[model samples]
Target: ESPNDHINSHSINNSINVISDDDVAMEDVIDADDSAAKHEQIIVKWICQRCTLVNSEHSDRCDVCSSPR
Candidate 1:
């Protein structure tokens, strides 16, 4: 086989592996969503010092001004 043919086959194999990995990740995401729906998540609100924009507690920076929290 030519070098080009070998490279093409290798890339095709890699793509197949990536697709399978993505399928597994999707299943995990679905499971996580189901568990999340079963629980109540508390989201704390924070006000930005510079822009006075209200942001979620999970965020490290202000959404409007991009100021660090």
Candidate 2:
């Protein structure tokens, strides 16, 4: 039990890795959620001006008031 005392030293695990400032970029983390919505076929519903009824955009005339588009 002097200055040269030894307790059977050994290694624990691998070396620790560090990331530099130039390693990653902000643009690399782009969101992929909006792409699905953009590719989807969304139906545009229009409101009838005559009776103020909500109708599907596919129909040329209003279903409630029969108003011409």
Candidate 3:
């Protein structure tokens, strides 16, 4: 009859320990892809042939994916 009698922390610890290096690598790749996908405003207009993503024509890089022109 104690206040702490009904706590289930065993499963939580097991789950935390189950994460593998592959999971971490996949997460990093996803994060990198996401970051590379963020748009940066460009003053000039440009076109992306691969993705159809547009940017400033005078811009050296694509705003949507950072692809070099």
TM-score of each: 0.37, 0.37, 0.30
Where does candidate 3 have its weakest 10-residue lDDT segment?
22-31
lDDT of 3 by residue, 6-69 (tens): 7555423222111123112111221232334433222334466556565544567677777777
Best model per lDDT: 1
Whole-model lDDT for model 2 versus the true structure?
0.48
RMSD to the hidden true structure, all candidates: 13.3, 22.4, 16.3
Q: How much is the lDDT of residue 18 in candidate 2?
A: 27
Counting clashing residue pairs in each candidate, in order, gives: 0, 0, 7
List the candidate 2 regions with Cα displacement exceeding 4 Å. 1-43
What tens-digit string does per-residue lDDT give for candidate 2 at 1-69? 775555222322222232223222122221243322222223356667788666666778989879986
lDDT, candidates in the order shown: 0.49, 0.48, 0.44
Output the better candidate (1/3) by lDDT.
1
Ranking by lDDT: 1, 2, 3
Instruction: Write down the worst ten-residue block by lDDT for model 1.
Output: 14-23
Model 1 CA RMSD to the hidden true structure, in angstroms? 13.3
The residue ranges of model 3 lying beyond 4 angstroms of the native Cα positions read 1-44
Compared with the true structure, what per-residue lDDT tens digits does model 1 show for residues 1-69?
A: 677865543344222111122112111221332333332233356677788776766789888889988
Q: List the residue pairs that clash in candidate 3.
A: 44-56, 44-57, 45-56, 45-57, 46-55, 46-56, 46-57
